[model samples]
Target: MISTQLLFGQLLLGLINGSFYALMSLGLAVIFGMINVVNFAHGAQYMLGAFAAWLLLHYAGIGFWPALILVPALVGLIGMAIERTMLKRLYKVDHLYGLLLTFGLALIIEGGFTHVYGSSGQQYPVPAALAGGWNLGFMFLPIYRAFVVAASLMLCLGTWLVIEKTRLGAYLRAATENPALVQAFGVNVPVLMMLTYGGGVALAGLAGVLAAPIYQVNPLMGSNLVIIVFAVVVIGGLGSIMGAIVSGYVLGLCEGFAKVFYPEASNIVVFVIMAIVLLVRPSGLFGKGD
Candidate 1:
């Protein structure tokens, strides 16, 4: 029998992983909803954020706290520029073009990083303040992991509130439904699209920053993770914000439990769940049926 401590520990780790999944999926959902573009470069942007944080620490003598704030902003700016200069031109074209362009961009970014940094993973020290753990009789909980969970939940909830409960969110929703109509109402739909793209990539960047200490900073880090996130997005239902959030956590926990019971199948558990979900509900857990 698995000890309670062991079970709970895996569950906690699952929740932490879920947090990142939720964040990345949220960004994907946002981009798809607003710009009608699937951002294959999102994983690259996430890698950029991790690298940005590392660069800041090595060259500028900055640390995690500052990087948490600055890295996402920098990435978001890069995303905005990409949208304005390159992605903007493809809006009138098929979404496949957008996907191909971003996939190409991902290859370029990852190749460049691999050339410069090599394939080895770089260690990012946990912040001094979060370097310890809490012992709760049954289990030892890493303080940093706890922080990741709390911070991710807050960020996810804040984003949801902004999108669902605010005037700006109303405009965004309106624009998503019919950009031309929104434009006729005097909203700057084009700029909004750019910003929405920026925001989505920014979320990816933020997740990267959070993941740095937990996972080694490496160019290929985001590639496999992004694939899993895409599965999460699909399982949650494409373009369903709440579905993405809930499915991320649910699937993460499922993966965690799978690891405990059938260690060999852990890696494929999420994909299995995704397949089942697809079969049962083609529209996703949270998505509306066509």
Candidate 2:
């Protein structure tokens, strides 16, 4: 029988990983839902955020606290620029064009960083304030890890609230359905599109910043996680925010239990679930029929 401590430990770790999945997949959902853009470069944007935090700390003496805010804003600007210059034009064309462009951008961004950074992972120290752990009777939990879970969950819920409850969100959904109609109403749909893409990219950057202290800061780190995040997005539904958030955490728990019962299958369990879900509902668990 598995020890309770070990079981809880893995569950905690899985929950941590799920935090990342929720953040990254939610960003994908926002971009896709708002503008119908695939944004394959999201992983690259995530890598950029981690790298930005590292660079700020190294060359500028800026720390995690400041980088937490500055990095997202900086990366979001880059995303907006890409949207204005490239993605905007592709909106009228088939979505394949946008996907190909973003895929190419991802390759270029990842390649550029690898060439410069030598493909080796660099360690990012956890902030001094959150550098320790708490020992519960059942399991030991790192303070930084706990902070990650709290912060990520708050951001996820906040994003959902802003997108689902606010007037701006309604405008966004309307633009998604009929941009020309919204534009005819004097909504400046182009600007909204730009901002929506920027917001999505900003969220990915924030996830990267949160991940820096836990994982190595590396060029390919984003690519490593992005595939699984994509799977999470698909399992949740193409553009369902709540779906992304819920599926990420649930799958994480599933992975945790799988490890105890069937260690060898833990790695493949998520994909297996994804396949089964797809077979049952091609549009995904929370997706709507057209």
- Which candidate leads in lDDT? 2
Over 171-202, each residue of candidate 1 has an lDDT whose tens digit, in order, gives 99999888899999899998999899999999
True-vs-predicted CA distance for residue 271, candidate 2, Å: 1.1
Instruction: For model 1, name the residue pairs that clash.
Output: none
Model 1 regions more than 4 Å off: none
Against the hidden reference, what TM-scores do the models get? 0.98, 0.98
RMSD, each candidate, Å?
0.9, 1.0
Runs in model 2 with CA error above 4 Å? Answer: none
Clashes of each: 0, 0
- Relative to the true structure, candidate 1 reaches a TM of 0.98
For all candidates in order, the CA lDDT equals 0.91, 0.93
| Clash-forming residue pairs, model 2 | none
